[model samples]
Target: MDAAALTLHDMTAADVDEVAAIESRVQSFPWTRKNFADGLAAGYRGWVVRRMGAMLGFALVMDAPDMAHLLVIGVRPDAQRQGVGERLLRRCIDHCRQAGLPALTLEVRPSNERAIAFYRRHGFAQVGLRRGYYPATQGREDAWIMTLALAADAA
Candidate 1:
């Protein structure tokens, strides 16, 4: 399906099950349902991408005073490469820009080349690396910290 057919909207508590399912299918170490609940409780910006009444993906963003962080983003495995991820990312970026944030940051597992490439394509630059940032099958793995500066005219 085309990404244009999907609608992006704020996620609700009822979406936890579907969102967790997508998260689990897309990642080796997925966030638990409790994680989503905690994010909601903390008033994070959590969004969902849906089409034909079915969820395609979701994203969670946490905003600080001067900066915003993409806490998590995932698309259902079957929806990969359909532009849903980009749409979700664009929404988060717009939110940060509208909030007058200086930048948006995220950490990606170094092994996730696809996500690294995607973020780089969307103007994120490698700022640093975190040692043992993500759990791995054998051991902990490092993550690349990336940031995208919000343009004055952004959003």
Candidate 2:
């Protein structure tokens, strides 16, 4: 897909249902519709990606005192590996930089090697681990905490 063909817009209340639906389809442990609504209500920075008026993905970020936290970033299953995620992530990084944040942080399932590789390729690094950070079909799962520091001279 051509990256230039995509459009991104700030997330709003009207987009909660569709964003949650996409989240449910893409994530095993998806955020509920209420979760998306509440995040928007709380003034989290969120965005929706569309192509030719079709929803392709969404991302939500929370601001911390010193950094931004990526709460969710999901791409439609059909859009995976097609650069939608990369564009969305670049937007997140840009947003953080515009906010003067020093870094961006997120936690991913340790089992999600593909996501880990994606983050690494985008300059994120494994910073720590959180025990029992997520529920699993069998038991709780560990989370890999990853961070991307935005240095003045860094990309």
Candidate 3:
């Protein structure tokens, strides 16, 4: 897909429903509409990727003086592996860089090898572990805490 074909926009209240729907479709443990709304109400920064007026993916990040936390991100099931998610992630990194944040952090399920690999490809590294950080079918799942340092000269 042409990179220019995708457009990024700041997420708003009106986008919560659609974003939540996409989240539900793409995640086994999805965030509800209320979750997205509350995040927005709490002043979390959000970005949505669209192609020809169709929602493809979205990312929510919480900014801080030291670092930015990627609270959650999701892409439409049909849009996976088409560079839509990568575009959204780049937006997040750009936001952090523009804010002068030195790093970005996120937690991922240990079982999600695909996502782990994806983050690794994007310059993220495993930094720590959070035990039983997520609810799983059997009991709980450990989370891999990943960090991406934003170097002064990084692109």
- Whichever of 1 and 3 has more lDDT, that candidate is 3
Collision pairs in model 1: none
Provide TM-scores for the models: 0.96, 0.97, 0.96
lDDT of 3 at 115: 96
**Model 3 error, position 135 (Å):** 0.7
Q: Could you give candidate 3's per-residue lDDT for residues 1-155 as a string of tens digits?
A: 77789899999999999999999998888989999999999999999999999999999999988999999999998889999989989999999888889899999998999999999999999999999999888999999999999976466
Misplaced by over 4 Å in model 2 are none
Model 3's TM-score against the true structure = 0.96
lDDT of 1 by residue, 1-155 (tens): 77679999998899999999998899899999999989988999989999999999999999999899999999988888998999999999989988999899999998899999999999999999999989999989999999999965566
The order by descending TM-score is: 2, 3, 1
Could you report the Cα RMSD, in angstroms, for every candidate shown? Answer: 1.0, 1.1, 1.0
User: Which is superior by lDDT, 1 or 2?
Assistant: 2
What does candidate 2's lDDT look like per residue over 80-113, in tens digits?
9988899889999999988889999999998999
Instruction: Please give me the total number of clashing residue pairs in predicted model 1.
Output: 0
TM-score of 2: 0.97
